[model samples]
Target: MDWQQILTNVAGEIIAPTTAAYALAAIGLNVHFGMTGLLNFGQAGFMLLGAYGYAIASIAGWPVWAAVLVALACAVVFALILGIPTLKLRGDYLAIVTIAAAEIIRMIGRSTSMTEVTGGNAGLAGDGFKGSFQELSPLPDGNFAIGPWSYSMNLSNSWWVRIVGWALVALACFLVWRWMNSPWGRVLKGIREDEDAVRSLGKNVYAYKMQALVLGGAIGAIAGIVYALPRAVQPDSMGRPMTFYVWTILLLGGAATVFGPVLGSILLWTTLMLVKTVLRDVIPATVLRSEQIEMLGWVLVGVTLMLLVIFRPQGILGDRKELAIDVR
Candidate 1:
């Protein structure tokens, strides 16, 4: 294997639109858990609904804007569905219900009965769905090179996706930062610290929680849109592992910080890519199979999470004060 080629491929993924997509989703999670103290483990469900909502609307000949609106609407509905019964409950219950609900959504999408609509296990195509977005590409149709890394302007279909994806990520980050610094954001922080106290202070704790869920879920929906833009939409793409990955990004970046999610995503993905590339190069091919290397990467992530929890639970940019929640 060409070691140089491996490094290049790894680097590409590190900065790819997908990384930004995850960052956006993790920022949403930061709002839910880091700020509001909501234990939402079903972020994948919101993402799935967003992806499917847009794809299905496009398939039905709706305008791009309408499709996006439908996706956002779906996210709101999902939030209401999950938040109505459990938002009043304690932390662990909310986590359990949300996680289970997310899995149920994924499994239902993969079911054969819904194959006609969801494409079932085969996934759905985005042929016309992405056309409108792609048409807005500002770059000329050709190749562009920078240093040892070069990318096709029009060849891989990633140009349009990257443009829109990065744009949305920037928008989400800006909105999150602004919101987190507002009076509403302060209430969220107060709720995270002591919901009962906020309620005693004449604040509507339940309403605040619901609003946080809706806003965070909406952000997750946008992440789903960006994530599915570059490729086909598959149910498996929004699996439990995806939520775990988002959580990892949130924690890695310092959950309550404005820019933590973005930085954490870039750092985590880059480190993962670099490790895979280096291991692929130095590890004796004769000793370890390709599949083994893949497993080894996951093992490393698990060990890293363990270490983080034990040592620096506040994450890279997180403050110990921000993480002081009364989950009990």
Candidate 2:
């Protein structure tokens, strides 16, 4: 096995734009599940909408800022549509609704009828939308290497994307930290602990829930935009599986903790990259095909996650008390 190459790949994953995108998504989910005890199984829907919104608006001649605003607006609309009628339902019911809603979005995006608008299954080419964002990069154009990693400073998947993606993550972490300590965050915690007690205290529980949903959804949309920065906006890529992955990342890092999502994202991607790289190098192709190797890597990762959940349900930084929820 080329151990140096494996190390390089793993190291690159630590700061990849994809990692930052997942981190942002997990942090958004943290706001919903960890802080407010809301069960949102459709975060992927938020992300998909954001990606589509940005792509469509950009294609329609909107400026970058306008496209971004359109993405956030789409998220807000989706949250309202989901939260208005279902926030009062049981958590499990909400989860079902959310997952279904997300699937609906993916199906719609992939439907042949919407091909002209959304590019259907093919999706919009990244080149069309990424230019606006790339043009905003202040980094000098050249091969910039940090240790084992090197790439264009201003092109797609470049340092500029990494910087912006991680900067958003840092800003998100700071905001979450600040919010969790404020009076509003205290009320969210109260709702998480006991809805009846909070409701009796005259808190507008519904309003707060709606607000949390919108905030988290907007963040998820931002994640989708980030994820699309280096690639096309394929609807299938942000389906139910995406939501599950975000959930896994959130839980792995420690839900309710300020930095749990970021920590979890870093660990999960690096670990996956390391496992895949080592397996590909050490195992011969005749023994295992590339796709099989990929599956095997996920199997190993899944087993590890199962063990972590079995032994430490509270996750790496989460408290058991914070995760306690009365689904009823």
Candidate 3:
């Protein structure tokens, strides 16, 4: 096994744009599940809408800013549509509805009729929407390296994407930290603890729930946009597995903590890369195919999640007290 290559790949994934995207999405999930005790299982739906919204807007000649606005608007609309009815319900009902809604959104995106607008199953290519983003790159157009691991800053147009995407992730994390410490944030915590108590204290629980939904959905939407920065907007990419991965990140990092999601993203992606690298190097080409390596990585993730839930349901940084939920 090439230990240097494995280390490099793990390091690269730790700082990759996709890691930041998942971090942002998981943070949003933290707000819903950890802070407000809302069961939002359709985070992928929010991401899908954001990706398609941006893609469709660009295709329709809208500016980047306008496209972003449209995506945010779509997130708000989706939140309201999902939250209005199910947010009032309790427990697994919300989960069931949200998951169903997400799958429905994915199917619609993959449908043939929406192909012209959404690019259908083939996915939508960026029509120069990334140009303005690329123009902001400060690094020179060449490969740069610290040691055994090196990468071309200009290769595949991803340098700029990583730059912008990480910036957005940082900004989102800062905003979430600030929001969680505010008075409004206190109310959210209270609602999580007991909505009835909050209602008795004269707070509008429903409004707060709706607001949480909207905010969390908007963050997820941003994640969707960042996730699509390195590739085309594909419906399959926004499927159930994406949502599950975000949840794993949320749970692994310690949900209620400000930095939990980001830390979780880094750790999870690093593990995946390390696994793939080690397996590829050690497992002979004749013994196991590359596809088998991919499957093994996922199996590791599943096992990790199961262990976390059973042994440390509170997550790495999570408080056991904060995890008190009346799902009954």
Q: Quantify all predictions' global Cα lDDT against the true fold.
A: 0.84, 0.92, 0.85
Ranking by TM-score: 2, 3, 1
Worst 10 residues of 3 by lDDT: 127-136
Q: Which wins on TM-score, candidate 1 or candidate 2?
A: 2
TM-score of 2: 0.97
Once superposed on the true structure, which residue ranges of model 1 sit more than 4 Å away at CA? 1-7, 154-157, 325-328
Best by lDDT: 2
Give the alpha carbon lDDT tens digit for every residue of 1-116 in model 2: 77888888898998999999999999999999999989999999999999999989988878889999999999999999999999998679989999999999999999999999
TM-score of each: 0.93, 0.97, 0.94
Give the worst 10-residue stretch by lDDT in candidate 1.
Answer: 152-161
Model 2 accuracy (lDDT, Cα): 0.92
Error of 2 at 7 (Å): 0.9
**Model 2 residue 56 distance off true place after TM-score fit, in angstroms:** 1.3
